[model samples]
Target chain A: MAAATRPPNRPPTREIDEQTDIGEVYMRSLLRAQLRRGLTVLAVVALFLAALPLLFTVEPRLASVRILTVPLPWLLLGVTIYPLLLAASWWLVRAAERTERDFAELVERN
Target chain B: MVSTDTAAWPAVLSVILVAVATLGVGAVGLRLSRTTSDFYVASRMIGPRWNASAICGEYLSAASFLGVAGLVLTFGVDILWYPVGYTAGYLVLLALVAAPLRRSGAYTLPDFAEIRLASRTVRRLASMLVVGIGWLYLLPQFQGAGLALRTVTGAPRWVGALVVGVVVMLNVVAGGMRSVTFVQAFQFWLKLTAIAVPVLILAVAWQSDGAPDPSRPQPPTVREATTVRVPDTVRLRVDEAVPVTMRGTLDGVRVDGPVVLETGRRVVEGGSEVTLPAGSVVPHVESVRAADGATWSQPLAGAGGRDHPTYRLYSLLLALFFGTMGLPHVLVRFYTNPDGRAARRTTLVVIGLLGAFYVFTPFYGAMGRIYAPDLLLTGRTDAVVLLLPSRMLPEPWATGVSMLLVAGAFAAFLSTSSGLTVSVAGVLSQDLLRGRLRSTVRGFRLGAVLAVAVPIVLSFATLRTSLADTVGLAFAVAASTFCPLLVLGIWWRGLTKAGAVAGLVVGGSLASGAVLWTIVFGARFTDAATSVGSSPGLLGALLAQPAAWTVPTAFAVMVGVSLLTRRSVPKSVGRTMVRLHTPERLVLDRGPSRREP
Candidate 1:
């Protein structure tokens, strides 16, 4: 919208290309945004998964706890983990696209 | 031990039906796919959900379909990591690789290698690794097919492998999966329904039968007079004295009548029939560790054949979590997306699809312990998924359920085998046969033949390892090689071609060497031989699952070499990184959006 309102003689608001320094800056921002979101998701997921084996080792008796008529380990691994993964991926994808859209908006404003 | 009553016509018919449907879909795809773009990446038009389903179809090989349940049945709680790691691998892929790879516009892993490193030599090395990994992955699909067919129809083991090999070859050679997206998507649903419907029925039946906990420590017993036939000579270690009527050669002694087995190892001759009266606990093969219900339900208590359970668990998790990004067939599907964002979306959906399918596998495994415990004795634990339906239900319903599973199993083999053949053959045709052949299509057909042939031959020659374990070896190789390559290639700007090659060579050789050693010497060094000292040998555990060391070694070597060779970094590194990381919507001077082939 900002580009559309600019003066017509201003060289047609050159599109962002990899050759330009400005475009490189734009691309860097996008990559940074993406990498940040990716690492956040990775950290959350890794923490949960890494915690599982540690939990089993630290409190070996926790496995004997039956939740909804199944062993806690089976319930966590066989049942709950699937939904957790689904939700995490959903959140990450949504956040990733939002970041992309925001970057696009920034590029458009220039 | 061929069953005289080979009357599984329904299962045979279902396998045939699946083959016909796959061929029919492949033929339609062939007609529709005329251009090189269509054959390689479906013209980059696939939507997120459909592409996600196709990925799941291709990814859920015999390892996921049958092996997970089999491993869970035999190894207990620790085996749950197989499915969890499989699904979570996508999480890592989505976070690290998916969007960037799609944006890179490289059609194959070798193509990506060339694009990132700017070296033909590195490309060739990547191609070799792709073929190696593909062949290793394909081996288990063929072997699993053989085992599945033999279990279902009592057909000779070779027939199933032959049938799957021929069928997959036809599909790959036909149009090179120009329309593979639809075929694979259909197969995903077919596999899901196959597992889900039977599991639902079995669950209801289980509930009606009092829903007994499978974690009970007592050994499983036959409800009626059952006769078990051993097709191959097997040494079984009995933990308890078991009384049975025998009409076979047992440990160099022939018995035509009743005999009691003492609690030690005994060898039974091939083609021998052992009839057991009602309520006799099933004897386990000597390699399988005997576990009570309490130990079976607990994690890390009894795993990796009773050796370094904690270390093995971490190592296996490392391999599987990172390995998903490197599977050739899995990565190629990402190219079908129109943009980086769509690729990420597809991966997100794939996590959900794969997660849903894996949830039911553990149920099948847990139920198998109760109903199909005899498989432990037969050393055919992989048959648990197929046997559970028929074992639990009686008569006509059992036959119908069995046929459903047979179709699903065939779908698993066909879809995965075809996917691997296409990816492998693509690399072979492009890189290996570049100047030798006049026509790329012809070269692809030749490559398809080679791709299917080597694995089939190897499947026949090698001693059969458990399907999932064999798959895990492939994962380790993939994690050690491509995982490092992709991560460094995408993220780090200073990565040199020399670094990639060195890392690949070191990582690939070590992981594959371990796999080859296992295949060659694993049978000889059985549980009896490996557990010589008080402490189970650490070398055996390391060799068994080398991902913990090999993956980190690969990353270190890659980073180390890249730092040394920083001056040789490609001049185009900045441009390539820009292309890989930028959103497609951003106007940029990307030469052509669509690749020719």
Candidate 2:
């Protein structure tokens, strides 16, 4: 509470350990940032996956088109999608670790 | 389908070698695992790369080893979604549950439930569901073993299941999680080599054959005169009548000469042998349609003869994408990582490893279309991977490659079965039998026996379905129940204990009910299609693929129930969230119950 004393010389980590109001704010902000990253990745995956069936359905003829003699659907779903998944996950891990590093810096600044 | 040559000996030899090697690897790690932490989670010291390999080793079951290719051989391109859904599931885990779950410091799913909600009831419910999902997943591994052994060595179905069950039980009881980790990582490399080498050889053989296109718009014809011996009574449909030399009873009449097969559904008695001339169309088993090459190669062309292929595909995807984190074995592997960052790194590498493994399955399916078309008639398309090597190469090479493939298939069975058994036994020992036993190790050993015993019995009793389909049902159940729990438990603070209980009950019952219905009725419906219909109606389709509806409903119920019971929210939620979200570097006063009891 604003009326409470500053608890002189107490560190921010102690506030978190004690579960003070300010500690809740710090945790909430970090969770929100992480949640945003997670949801963004999820939305991108959901859209890409959903649109694939739609593409094949609306344009059945595209199935016949071949790149390097492999069918489009086979190339897209069977082979290429895996590397794409790996890439997306790699990018996400980096972004998340960076967010955590920033949060660690903020919490320990005091 | 029977191989009488001396080559079958090598295949049998390879299986024995793999089994011995598995136990040997576990024995080497035996001394390292002494404490309860070592037994449960390898003391949380497994490095990222080793953990990733162990995860993949455990994750790629009989379904990935055999079923994916078989589906592709019979159904076509749409079935590729199985591998995609499988690999992408880890991506979702990496982005969402992997790091936070590791940070939660829970050894099992039930442990996580009790830690987050502080409720005994929720933990009990989660333990039951963990046992349920683990058993469901294990059933397919045993059946796949039977199928593989039969294909390679002419053994009866039960022999393979019994062998794998006994091996896995011994390993888990002896070494626990630490030894199993080393064995699994070793098996992953073994399996990759076993499958990848044969694929390369087959690819070269195809090239030398001028790389014939497999997508021709006609029924695949045998390049040479092929003799197919029916192991079981099969009802098959011949699209075009052809004269064939036969040596068995046809239409219940004894005939041993050239006869023109009629162009409708005919029931061939078991032990009948039919020899078709070169360049003749392959008659398809009743369960699958006789699809031309174009239809087989195209996506969503109704290649598998199912009523609603599109609905099934999407539903399968939904279940897999959300289900990976909910797997007890999978979550247990994450706990072996030292921290949240290592967990994320391990998951990322896992996605890549899985992707690399999956890239070869579709190749087997396509090659099977050309080289092993007789599998279509026998309706044992799941044997495509095992049989392709024999069909594609000459005698010596064929025998040798076939041996390697059978060994790889066995590796798939052993690694996955052991992983599932350990996780299930962990839960059992910790929660179910905690009061009865004095020492943790004795309890875990007893728990391992019970865990493997039930699934082994069920594998013998239940009718055999395709490996991928049975595994898919497991994912669906997990997706409906634990997916909601993990996602909400880690990310949301408002999730009350009552809400978690309500969601698990609703989601668990609905998804598992659909699974039970599909397993019992779906097999019978396929076998006796004339009695019911060619395809299941809308209700049957909905039950066949329940994840599309059940997952969302579970999420909704959890959120709604939590809001209504706002007053009952755990007072420690903020502290729990801090532990879950903050970086591991920032030491905080975690509660006394940080470790599993």
Candidate 3:
């Protein structure tokens, strides 16, 4: 690994072909935007938790908070939200990385 | 204790096929284990998809397969919280810990300790605690194997324990993390397929039979109490009651083994359990209306009545809810991926695999609801999934399902025990013998032996608690110790060396002592007076679940200590912070060799 007179940060910015790779650029930008707002990500999560009970299955008897009724909404929050969290985390990171690197490069090139 | 109704050949053949396939994966991994990184951390080269599968294999252990199903069957709706919390653990893991830990570039918890605290003593204590908890958790996997093998094949219980122990040792010794990675990855799919196939078959069978008689409404439950000549002075409470079939009666009474019990009590020894007509009343039996508007199928003792203690519920949830973040096997998975993002992605994948798997647990319990509801009576509710295949299908069809479950159970046991063994060995090697021994190879061997010894002993020693309960104990300990470390370490900049040392020592010791107290001597003081205020007192006792208070206290102590000694903070803090927040590709070498602040 030879040293390349390294800058402060590097984003994967080499253009393969301007006409062909425009889609890639836009997709990366969208991913990058989502990852940048960590506070918003957490806020939406808090909101989702507050709102999910309204979305419980229509069986009122089963939806009852009583022990016998098999509470469904808690199960959805407890079991199902995990994968979504993971996916959100991933999207946030790749997006966060792109943004951080770009900002660092902007500073370095200045 | 009874012969399986299904043919044994398919179960045997599939178990053999899985074993062979797993061994083949290990052998392939062996060929790839040429370097230090490959030996210890799979060279940090694995991608998200493959690593995610391996994480699932290791993560969904005996606790998931047998414990959750049994818990739901015995406790009804409230117990689904176990799986709920177990999976939610990853949500906590992702939200706080995963990315930064990976970015920290440490190999094990001890490594993390050494780097963060810059204290060798702190690192050593953390390593011992990791080994202690890993071995404690592995016991249940071994015990589950024994239970599974005996249940499935009528093989001796020791045979299953020995089988898992040997397989895990061989895999770890042969290729360290590399072999286990491949083996665990394959087992995840095999395990998923194992449970998924049976669940689908059973669901289709139920559909064919018109959906479990949901319209029948629960029958009027009955409990029969004849003065059975008491056998011994010690009374036994079945943790939860299920219908039982008995053969003999005491005091010259005509012994009818198949009668139902309306018993809402926590423990029942042995009795008859059959659904009777709702309106009909037998002369000898006492009728009890289902409590709390829930009916049975045998009424789950806890949810079906207002009778159960809330303290037990709090204890159980405490053990599971915070316990997840502390596990050795789960934490090790985070390190296998190439970067924090990968760790986060893999965790997400695990959530899908685990969530989909958990959705089927209630179905297994519900099957016990229909076909083999007898298991609940036998007080072997944990065996619901195992006994399920036999109860639902006709003799031959049921046999195939039973074998599928047995194979899946063994996979659960082997994958988890092996993963736990690897982490334990890594910690043991890196800390205990790391500096003492000049050669890494020698340290690996010692760690391997140390890892297998304690768990095998504990697996044999534990007799009172169900394997699931013991596993819960382990989770509680983990929640207390490591969960605090990871969560606080990632988010807080002010956590100091003295604080981490204090937390791991204070937190780890208390949690472990609580577990040991319950298992070893607590039952002896029985009125059974383990937690009844005689010794540790119920609440004041070393509650096995530590995170309820310890996690927060640990975090507070660390911060408080750091602030008090603000001038003593490490010079590397700025660099470490930078490294953690920086993207992986920005760094020149992927090695967490020198962290950037």
Candidate 4:
């Protein structure tokens, strides 16, 4: 199927190869989408980490709260943080992959 | 207590088993890894799952296996940040660095530097940092081995270090990267079982003891009459006065009778013995303050004696979050992925695997506080994990549990040291001995010997610090130097050769200089300042944890220099970015292929 289309639909591929204005636009769009997703994940993590210390400072009692015989800090920092990290990473992977997939389809369609 | 000979057998056997198993796995890889590509990156055929296991196996060093629990034992909730930061580092790596780095197709960090900036000077600078960081990181692994050995078996410290050094060198020299991958993956499981099984046994024992709360709001007390031995002369701060039977010298005078210890810092001479009655408060070494249960369990309460706890915390978190991306050994594992997406998947799995391993460490710390408070008094809290099993359990069970923990710790040292040797040897052979040698594999073998030998010799002469602190210093240097160069080089097109070089120099020197200062002058400086009746203050905190300042400054220098040298940007920047960003499935016409240097 790819071989059938390659003979006639060479213009889009040529544009990317020749560094034409259209190709530059295509590359920039993909880069921007991926970068935005990356930055968003970074911002979420930074906010989450920074807020924990501030929250502890604001309400010291939170540290003492216990759930199922485990203190709040132990529950949050030791146990809960791992799943949160995995979830965030999982989210980014899906988002980044989707963005890349969309760009791949767009380039191939042209 | 059970006889010393009975206890030694299990630990001794565990160490031997781990050593033989690690070398055996490497031998399997030896037959398959005959080519240069196989030696450097497992021929780039590893799938995400196996690759993730390999990365975690290699990444979880003595610091994670033993040091985290020890830190948590010494200082309560605040120490959790170390494990959190260590794992979260991979999150940051996945989000920013992983995929693009794999896409760049660089074998070593120096190769990445040259590929991105196209400058021989930048590559050379990066090569030096890789060797420096590798050696610095390996120092603690060797020391941790000796410490663990001495604590478990009555063997002299150097025996353990020599054993680990020889075993790791042989593995690296024989199989290189391919063999190390299998060995690391196998050890990761071995380590997981080694650490996990004991925690389960201890938890059961704790339950039988009625699951006593370790977070009580008072100074920790010995549940029974405990005799504490002081190895070196240490200053102890006693909170409340108590009558204690003493042997050896105290406060420059020899007294072997009962004496009332004052409620202040008392100098306890080396080789002194003190037996305190049951339910007495455990006096801590002056360096680690004794925290009451209420304060010890509270977050941000600052149990560690260091001033400016919040500042130190932030700096430590920053260094760890950014530094994982820059580690040469860690980065080299990512290149084993087939493409960009596999790299990301592998890192995500790594985060999960590391998190699973870390969840068991805090329990060890809390259990140690309840079962073995004497460690705090002895200033050997790093041995908390190794000693906990014996303190809590009786007879045969104690010996069995102790064996598992010691073997796990030894596995941690062997796997991490071999990983470091491979990375350092890879860089050494490629750039340092590029044209000087005929065969790549032979050069790598020679590099492996040089890499492992230096740190083993240095570990003997240097005073041992906590495993976590030494590893943290290596992270800070990596975060300051390569973190900036890779972040800017991959993402930003305007980054020039001049800017990258400037950032590496500024960041590398400052961070490493701080590390050197902390290692050599830190104790003397603190002592001198305290003798004159003043704290070392802000200057000391900054030097101890420089990453909070160094990372941002590195980013700034790279950007500022690049902006100033705008015209010197590489003409191939566009092509490089395309290669880095595009999906591997997209068969774009990416022009002429660049030759390997």
Candidate 5:
């Protein structure tokens, strides 16, 4: 199917064309809002992950865990999964959209 | 909790269900797998929801099923990094490789290797490595299935392993990627429902059952050892433990522990439990108890504090954290989506699914603290989830539930193993026999056998490292190899074939060496450095991960060499990069002509 393009509710493209250095001006203005929102989400996720240990009941009494009577903290830590995923997913979405938008703009202008 | 009369029929039945479903799915997918594109990339048309479901099924393998909960049970709270890494790995994939790699007009890693650098030699080397890594990753999946079944139904270990291998091989050979996608999507729902239903039931049961009797207690924790709460049936270790009575809490859940510990070491876990020795006195454990003044509604184990803090553990963790972006199975999922935007959405869904599932893993691990505390002594924490079903639910129903879980878990392992295998095989067939094989059938045949044999051999040999560690190591190596490849391949205009080779060789060698070292060290001793180093494979990859270091390192080396010999640069380099990132509608000659609607 032809790509979907429902532009945001704002002044039409014909109005923006009137400005001097309008093409670079308009494109930068277009990308600015999205970049800011994406960065905000990123910062929030990072803060949340940093704060997780405080909320948990992991007031560590001992450090060593046993595997066949072997110390297991090394093994156990590898599987700490939930937070990292949330961060990665958040990061991936932002990057994908950014890359796509940047490339599409470059192509349209040329 | 084992009622002695384990007829093995339940376990066998579960395997049969998985096999039937796999066969059915593969057969159906085969009808769609008529063309080369369909067999390789599902015609590059899978939508977000369907692909997301399939990715979930394929991603949540033995590691997520048995290993995650087991780690939580053994190590306390520190192990949450794994599921997070696994899910986030996709994020890395989306950002680094997804759109461009899909745009590369190639089907497999080896195919990418040859196209980017135009080197037959590099393709062969990558093909060999892909098989090696694919097999290394597959062994744990097979071993996990065997472990799951053995714990759940007392079936012989090999039965579980052999059955999954056969099932996966059939699925792959019959339908290839097209078939696997359907099977995996279904498996994801099955596996999700399998775990989700039990967790809900257990939560309700735990709330209504009231706190474990507050009198007698078991080992590891101080508690009333008089009462027990098993969400599933597994062997309890209280019969032979020098019960350590103490109080504990997991994620703020107050678990009054008169825990029957065989020893003081209860954290940094590789999943251990107290098992009854034959000569020892207590045959069957009666019940465990809760403590007085335990305020929390549900009591859980306390997380362990800093063990011998190591720079190495941090590095290993860094490798896993950043390295997930490099995993092939995960990267393949991103390609399965329609575009970069869809890839991002799917990643969000995956994070939700993965995180919610992780929240409940600790509960299963904590339940093991009471009912089948003996699992520790067996040195197989990975089997804890498979065993939990029977211990929590009542007879026939418990067995049936456990049987279903083992099947689902097995499907998880089989699907992931085959998926990786298919990717590697695609690389091998294209690189080694691109022109020589002469037919797609020949390529598929060679790839299929290579996929099955390597992992089966590794599984049979009993690699010393744990399943989670091996997988982490794989992530690390993947990060090292592909992390640089994707970042440099997409962003930099100056990247040369020489640089790509250097980054891949240096990063891959270091990561592979770490795997070898960890395997060797794991067999002899559990010394602190050696214990963590046993899986330095990923850490080595981490040193190379952002490829910021390795890519530049590679770029510098390539430029110096390329400057020294400028004639070797390929004419197609500019065109290739342009094709890789350009929008589909803009291109005059649309790529991947083999794809059909």
Candidate 6:
């Protein structure tokens, strides 16, 4: 019975075993990090977008305001929103990859 | 309007050029693709940039290419939400679904259903929904192509639909997803250039013309003696008396002489011609509420003029935001990435690419409002994108630019149709043709034919709805059904097979039923119908944009049913959860290894 239950000579080849307890920890942390980053970005962007309708409603004059000869709503929705989304996504992608890399490092060290 | 004699050759040539380009690119990719994996998911070796380009290519259908500018031109600032919501959807996808879905290692949404629930019943339900949503989505592409061709060349509407149908079928059956990716990626750049260069030239022309604001009290007028032809009987609402040369039939009276169009509406018969004097105010279609410069330029103050404006705005926002993730073609593209991380990166790049492309559309729309305002009278505002360049520029340049735009428009149709065909075919071949077709390729080929055929038949039977409106309905259906499934399937652990099926059936039926009603009887529920009662018609408004309620109901049913069937949860839920959330670096003998041992 002792011989039958003897430990394997080789160490676990893969850094993370998803079925095991430690693997679950690694997965949960990575997911938490990702979720946190995603939520942060989502909240900021959503608030910004949601506020546009409110601003137009509350101060109807805001729509007509011309900044550099362009209508306010046109500038906001048409020109600026695209770049803002691109910037936010770029930052989110960088942060997500960083979190994954750190998790990979932690697993490798273990 | 430019005569068909002059316009037909260039437009036809552009269409042929686009078809050849697409076929050539697809053929090249077919030669490169030698295995089943390549046909389905491009062997999971696509880089982030190329994948993102391909996604944008497929995602920017006729709606993005033509309908957006047209909507913006007609409705002003409120319509900008279409482009905004469209781009922002990827952000939501990136944040929530991107990585996890790729990590799930499912080739299709149905595959994801099977993998997560370990139930064939859920898979079958998903397969039906996928095919349904795909058919609904494909209907608009074919219709838009028909409209574009008929508007450009005097070809019968069916000719355009048939051409696109044949080209897309050939590409899809020949190479499947592998060919589609390259074709779509190339089309994206081509579409970008087509719109961008003309926009630049038109902007310069507009600046030269003193950048006249279209929102002035004076309505749009013809610059030249233009003879307008009505293909179908239409009601023209005149705000003031206007003298015009009438031919064929007007208000059922046949007269080939000058007549006065007084205030209020008059019917123009099919195959009739009316010539308006230069500087005469363009007559407005009864369906589109005529807006002056001030109202046209203002936000939410135009055609859908201020009644339940908030509800309409939020409903549309909800549909576009959530609906994108549920699009079968979009989801299938995620399966092409090697791992979850690559998928996330691809989504990030996609947001950037899509954002860049969206900026050009609104510019064209604003320009079209100024340059091609006659479309308002025709109620074919969707043609504004194609017409603006020719209207503004000089002869040869106009023809050249028009050709470019037409080619880009065709590319939009081909790329999107091909993508839709591959996805629908993937589901059809897998689910319906199982055990019958000896080879997967043969099944897929047959599936492609079925996918394109249904939409082609529907396109002929239906009246041409506004391109964006038709596409929006498809989005509503997708949002109501698959959005709930994906969000719950990824995030929730207790999602049972019974709950999924119930949610799918309930949500899918309600939204699609609303869509069918809208498509069939929508023309009768115009603005005039709302004036019959003091109170707004709640049913018509609800049916018009059903996503706000339908999506929530789906989520509620899914969650509630899931709770009731807790005991029915698959035992492998724990393992599935770990596999989904974990990074690709994590290795466990959950099943067959992706890499060879």
Position B155, candidate 2: lDDT: 83
Q: Which prediction has more favorable lDDT, 2 or 3?
A: 2
Candidate 6 lDDT: 0.82
Which candidate comes out best when scored by DockQ? 2
lDDT of 1 by residue, B58-126 (tens): 999999999989888878888889899999999999998999899888999999998888899999999
Residue A48, model 5: lDDT of: 52
Indicate which candidate wins on TM-score: 2
DockQ of each model vs. true complex: 0.56, 0.74, 0.11, 0.64, 0.16, 0.47
User: Which 10-residue window of candidate 4 chain B scores lowest in summed lDDT?
Assistant: B526-535
Clashing residue pairs, candidate 4? none
| Candidate 1 similarity to native, TM-score | 0.94
For residues B1-597, could you state the per-residue lDDT of candidate 2 as single tens digits?
322123458878988999999999999988899888889999989999999999999999999999999888888898899999998899889888999899889999998998899999999999999999999999989988987887788788788999999999999999999999999999999888887899899999999989988888888777777788777677888888978888887778777989988899877787888888888898887777778887887777778577787887788899999988899999999999999999999999999999989998899999988877878877878888998777778878988888888889999999999999999999999889998999999999999999999988998874647788888889999999999999999999999999999999999999999888778766675542111123367777788778999999999999999999999999888778877878788877766548545
Q: What TM-score does each prediction get for chain A alone?
A: 0.80, 0.88, 0.49, 0.85, 0.39, 0.80
> Higher TM-score: candidate 1 or 2?
2
TM-score order, best first, reads 2, 4, 1, 6, 3, 5
Model 6 Cα shift for residue B455 (angstroms): 0.3
Per-residue lDDT of model 5, residues B72-165, tens digit only: 5544444555565565555445444556676666566666667777787666656766766676678788778666676656666677777777
lDDT of 5 at B118: 77
Q: Identify the runs in model 3 with alpha carbons over 4 angstroms from their true place.
A: A1-95, A98-103, B1-10, B213-323, B435-438, B521-544, B587-597
lDDT of each: 0.84, 0.87, 0.62, 0.85, 0.57, 0.82
Q: Model 1: how far is B121 from its true place, Å?
A: 0.7
Q: Which ten residues in a row have the lowest lDDT in candidate 1 chain B?
A: B527-536
Candidate 4: regions farther than 4 A off: A1-10, B1-6, B255-257, B525-535, B591-597
Question: By summed lDDT, which 10 consecutive residues of candidate 6 chain B come out lowest?
Answer: B527-536
Each candidate's interface RMSD (Å, one decimal) is 1.9, 1.1, 9.6, 1.2, 9.0, 2.5
